[model samples]
Target: EPEVTQTPSHQVTQMGQEVILRCVPISNHLYFYWYRQILGQKVEFLVSFYNNEISEKSEIFDDQFSVERPDGSNFTLKIRSTKLEDSAMYFCASGRDSNTEAFFGQGTRLTVV
Candidate 1:
């Protein structure tokens, strides 16, 4: 069986610094996405990347955010400038197609101070 893997698991950063969250999903998966949960809030979709470009994105994915696959095997999300409100659990997910179920990583807990 294959699953998504995220690195660092936990991260603490200064409010003004930049943070990069990494994830690796099943090799055969074609769709990848980033989502976040702010403590008591619902899991919110940030962006979806497919075919090497962003396929969809939520308002939450503004100018401060960006994502890329630096290598064919890894996907990453970068926050240009962290904010206190950015503290949350960020999850990486992947699926075979738009209609298929997505498998999620445990998540990287980010804390900004």
Candidate 2:
């Protein structure tokens, strides 16, 4: 069985710092996405990437955030600047295609103080 893996399951940072969350999805998956859940809030979609470019993005993925596939095996999300409101659990997910099942990583809990 294949699954998505995320590093540094927990992270703590200052309000104005920067953070990079990493994830590795199943080898054969073709669609990748980043989603987040703020404490006590609903899960929200951030952005989707495919064919090495952004396919879709939500309002939450503003100028402060960026996604990259630095190589064939890893995907990364970088936040240029962190804010107290940026604290949340970020999940990395991948699917075989647009209509298939998507596997989600355990998530990286980010806390900004």
lDDT of each: 0.97, 0.96
lDDT of 2 by residue, 82-108 (tens): 999999999999999999878999999
For each of the candidates, give the backbone clash count: 0, 0
RMSD per candidate (Å) reads 0.5, 0.6
Candidate 1: segments with Cα more than 4 A from true spot: none
The estimated TM-scores of all candidates read 0.98, 0.98
Ten consecutive residues with minimal summed lDDT in candidate 2? 1-10
Quote the lDDT for 100 in model 1.
92
**lDDT per residue as tens, model 1, 47-77:** 9999999999999999999999999999999
Candidate 2 residue spans exceeding 4 A from truth: none
- Indicate the residue-level lDDT of 88 in model 2: 98
